[model samples]
Target: MPSPLPSRASAAGPVPGRYDRFLILGAVCLAGLVLPLSFTAPPVAIPAIAAELGGSPVALNWMTNAFMLAFGSCLMAAGTLADTYGRKRVFSIGIVAYAIVSLLLALAPSLAVLNGLRIAQGVAAALALAGGNAALSQEFHGPARIRAFSLLGTAFGLGLAFGPSLAGWLVQTQGWRSVFLSSLAIALLATVFGVPRMRESRDPDAAGLDWRGSLSSTAMLALLTIGVLEAPERGWSDGWVIAALIGSAALLALFVRVETRAARPMLDLSLLKYPRFVGAQLLPIGTGFCYLALIIVLPVRLIGIHGLSALNAGLMMIALSAPMLVVPFLAAVLSHRIAAGTLCAAALLLAAAGLVWLGVEAAAGSVHGLIAPMLLIGAGSAVPWGLMDGLAISVVPKERAGMAAGVFGASRVSGEGIALAITAAALAGLLQLRLSSAIGVDGATLTQAAQRLATGDAARAQALLPQLDAAALVHSYDAAFAWLMYGLAGLTAAIAGVVFALLGDASAHEPAALAEPARDDRIELADEPAC
Candidate 1:
């Protein structure tokens, strides 16, 4: 079982909390762990899911994309609901809903059914994450809040670290459906521990939900994701692809207009004016390029192109995620002494270097060459991951914690979805170019094969191009992947510079004036150290 988060009180806040508060932290942290499992584990199970359910590569791809799309797009709305209704109420509903959706996912009859359920699961996840994180901000303040979020980051790391390996074992032994059971069990535990003790809190001044902003933003994200995910399967020039892209742009403008005009906007457009706030938003986007993209892509490359067993591929992934287990806590500790912008910039630079190293190593096509680069990337990413949540809410007033959490969470998750889609599409397009040059196949044939290969459906990819052996496919994929890595490296490096400039030196300090508010539901802690 995962350990509970520390309840140590910061000097700026009141004393310490009772055991019940620890239970609340445990529940939220467990739920946090489950979200990453839903993400990282499923990629490891793709081949198993495809083998049993028999879906097209595009359909299999949507299994992940659909969930991320729903989760990312709904986060701001979930945050709004959390603040308007009650944080505890929304969290309870979300946890219950997540448990139900997990069961449905386990029993799904087809990929299509599973995809629909995954979308529901994503919405539930958004509610749980946004509500839980917002509620946590109410419970802690000053450095304690940073530690709380740091532990949350560690929980996320735990899931990412073990999810692939654990899912591999479950899929190998109990079948692919068992992966969902893991989430079901965790959700149940979270519900039991978190729901009963969590104190209900809401914004006293909140007017109501910003329906227009919610709908427009959600629609914009959906269209953008659809456009990116479809680009590889349908050519970029296809009418529907062009239409979706244009629709996404139009909706984005509509969303911006709606938010700016609304009396009580779901997201305050004015927050973007703060350089530190903008920098906090960019943190996840930078990690999306360097870390999250690899989480989706590398498993496919290892299992499908390299022909590794699910178990082996998953174990191999541990190298990339293991640093997450400790690096986040270390980064949090370092924040007290280091300027946050400098720390984050240095971390991103490290990840950029790792990406470049990985690109060189990938060209050699050896598993051993991957470890150092992956570890470096993971460690670098862990720094920003640990600090981002705390920094997000800290930048805004305490009264707007929900909105702050929502905006940051939305930016983070949606950036992930966009990065994954763009990376997949870019890989497919690059592979098509390689295939055209190498095999001289027709555009249609090359396109189909590249799409399948990009999504890790090597069996169908083989069927599409039976003339090419596995080695040839692997070679083509490696070339494309190497180029992709180099591009990501350059982008990551550039983002680091921008983040440094925007965050500045003042972003790290948590002023005591912004201390914890006294509330009826606030838990009072003892002055002693937490066990």
Candidate 2:
């Protein structure tokens, strides 16, 4: 079957007045800020949460994973809903739902309850993000539209840049619950400011949602994450672990079949036909592992194992994330001078170098030595973070720009979720290797010890293994962490080589292909198709 054309909105109703613009921007910006804060803040609170509620490392990992996996999985469907329904209506409902979920999260009684509520929170995040971005496209024009999106990016960056520190402070002074309370306040403000001022908009010819494609994709990611997260706890050869991995593979095949068969597929599987486009998608996955994984992993290492206070851990995280605020703008400027593809590959190389440096410093137990390497990683990752979205669509035909953007966005967030799961598992597995060889512990005892120590719960791990002392556990952790870093560096360097080859010489022609859109509206013109 031929693919359905993307929908186009009818002429927008009366545009918001000056006062109304502030309300609209304020609401969406707040919503934007809430997304990253909800995502990045919880890792710092994991040890605290585990202390209070009691949870295994797998369950603790889910506190962040569940939210991200659900958010990334449901994002395409949420965008479809916004278009089929009304942007304003969907945005309103999403903010309200976010507020309610945040409130419930603040009062979560158990890890199970928190994880379930986190899923709800993730869905709400998807709704708010999809609706808010769709509404912005309708309300703003030309430079105003560019400025609006720039502000949205700023809010998102600010959340990422400061989320850990703020959460650290809250978890230090108030409690882990205060992080959700903070999210609740932002959602409430977004509702008050945005819901009232936003004008309703929707595509007149939006297609029905692609339920088969959406469900299959979401299930595939869920199963894969579950399989990876559980592998370290239950040995990879375990029957249940095998079943989950096999189930995920089956769902992956199902997702491909569904997308290929659907009239209006959530992702245009055909886009994968372009080698350059495939390379572009890898950009996100590279950062997801090299950068985003550390957003959670490092905090656990610092606060849980190193025994730093939450506030100090958050402050340390700044060296790893603060460059996001400035470097992206710098990248946007530098793209005009350098080949975007060359720039991206160089950025990854820089991150790889930083990772190696970090491994050396961390293994040596030098806290101050970590700062420069962390900054380098942050800056290097930020360059690609700014350029990949534009590169995704720019490499595709203009008609499929909407599909390319949707796919890239999905890949970006979903890749981060999968990366987090895989990286956490790898850390635990490596730690297990060291623990087993050093102490001859295996099975549940070995798995439990590795998981706990890997996640920054050294006290519990020691309790579980009476023969293991604090010094030994810390030594094992450093060894595992060093190996994880070197492995990531090698992976990143290899990705850089592959991307460089796939995108060879395209950089020379990129400027001409991108110039028109950059000069015209600085965005895709097509209305987003329903997923």
Candidate 3:
């Protein structure tokens, strides 16, 4: 393939002395690796991190959630800042900040300090990673742009694939501190490569930042995420959970109101009117809610319900994860013949089918029934895994690329985050209800039986309530699992139809810029983009 970057831009070029895009792509890929590695590796180190810091379970959970909360909420705002102040400037500073914060995270003496530093580390990562992606979009076009994005996908996959094993080894060999300490290399590499080679680009006509929109958007997302994350642990009806859920909805509506009136909104509201962009945006949500939920639930079921060894359970996960990582790269070959929307919809349908297939296996209540379903889900997941990011940002102008990158990240993060939450809430709610009905007993015996059943202590459960109908309870649990899977399947199918309906053949493989926003109107940015 021809190089995506020219040796140098002509002095008279339209974008003004643009640097080699390949160098920027390199930086972006490295930055992309941060998320998957940060997410996957740290869990393996959780025990060590807690041991050294004298951590409580709450604090331990926050150690991971703190990073994600900060990272996910601030992404769009960070992108807007990158675009306004200049991508190169923000990106360079972010790299340095990331390095410093990561070091602090590694050496933090207290759990509180470690949690605080994780939050800081996440903010810094958002700046570097989003800025780098926007830089690539600004510099490259057409086939080169696609290839660069593919490489970013590859970097993320490699991180996910290698992170757990590497982190496990590092923790065993050196200490848990090695996980955070090792991240310094990623920051260093990105800064060294990006600071010089990344060209400065921003909306010169863009007005001041929309602090209102930024704060509201951040609060809305953060609150909603907190509510969801706490739901399974705290129970959905807990006072704090109820308040958070209500507060998030209120903030969301307020955020929409603020964006519409703001002189310079952080997220552009105008872009949402476009059908194709909306379709691309939904793709992540659909795939994420359906197949991603399977990834979370299946392993638990394998070990808990099916009574598989951890090793065997992991192998089943491989059936899902292996294809998920591999098929995206292969899907690129079909671009020449297939419309992007068609392929995207087809991918969602495949994933939907896979979810239903899993439900069927779940209904069978046998460990042996899972292999084919896992493989099917894995293959389904791979199809849109390659295309969703590009589809999200492609329709917007290159200048708004940072905002688009932020949107892309937010969609995936939110989708995965919220999907898991929804699935948990649904299953928990339905499980309790059904378990109560099927396990016919009154008073304390019913409550005790329910708890034991939830813990998978069949013998104790039977003893707790001799009247408990064994087959009835089993049917109820199976139904709960099936309810989640099949519901997700239907949702994915609907989203697929929306994508196929909204997107035209001509707009499918190509970025569709319907019309430029009037200069005076290009003030506010959207959560997704300059929508």
Give the number of the best model, judged by lDDT.
1
Identify the runs in model 2 with alpha carbons over 4 angstroms from their true place.
1-10, 14-27, 43-65, 86-89, 107-115, 134-154, 157-161, 175-177, 192-205, 390-406, 435-448, 459-473, 501-531
lDDT of each: 0.81, 0.75, 0.71
RMSD of each: 6.2, 5.4, 5.6
- Runs in model 1 lying further than 4 Å from the true structure: 1-18, 43-61, 107-113, 437-442, 456-473, 506-531
Candidate 3 residues lying further than 4 Å off, grouped into runs, are: 1-20, 157-162, 442-479, 504-509, 517-531
Query: What number of clashing residue pairs does each candidate have, in the order they appear?
Result: 3, 0, 11
Error of 2 at 499 (Å): 3.5
Q: What is the lDDT of residue 118 in candidate 2?
A: 97
How close to the true structure is residue 292 of candidate 2, measured as C-alpha lDDT? Answer: 81
How well does each candidate superpose onto the true structure, as a TM-score? 0.87, 0.80, 0.85
Query: For residues 193-241, what per-residue lDDT tens digits would candidate 1 score against the true structure?
Result: 8777676666666788888988998888778777776775676888998
Cα lDDT tens digits for candidate 2, 1-531: 122333343433455698899789889889989998998799879989999999997789889878877887677677666665667777788889999999999999999999999999998888888778767655664335434554565577678768877887899899999999999999999998778777776544447668887788778766766666566567678888789889989988999998888876766677576677788878878887788878868877887888887668768888988888887677666655676677888899999999999999889876768899999999888777766655664565333333444465567776765676678888999999999988886888888888888879999999988888898888889888988988888888888888787764344223113212222322222322212
Error of 3 at 22 (Å): 3.5
* Residue 278 displacement in candidate 3 (angstroms): 1.7
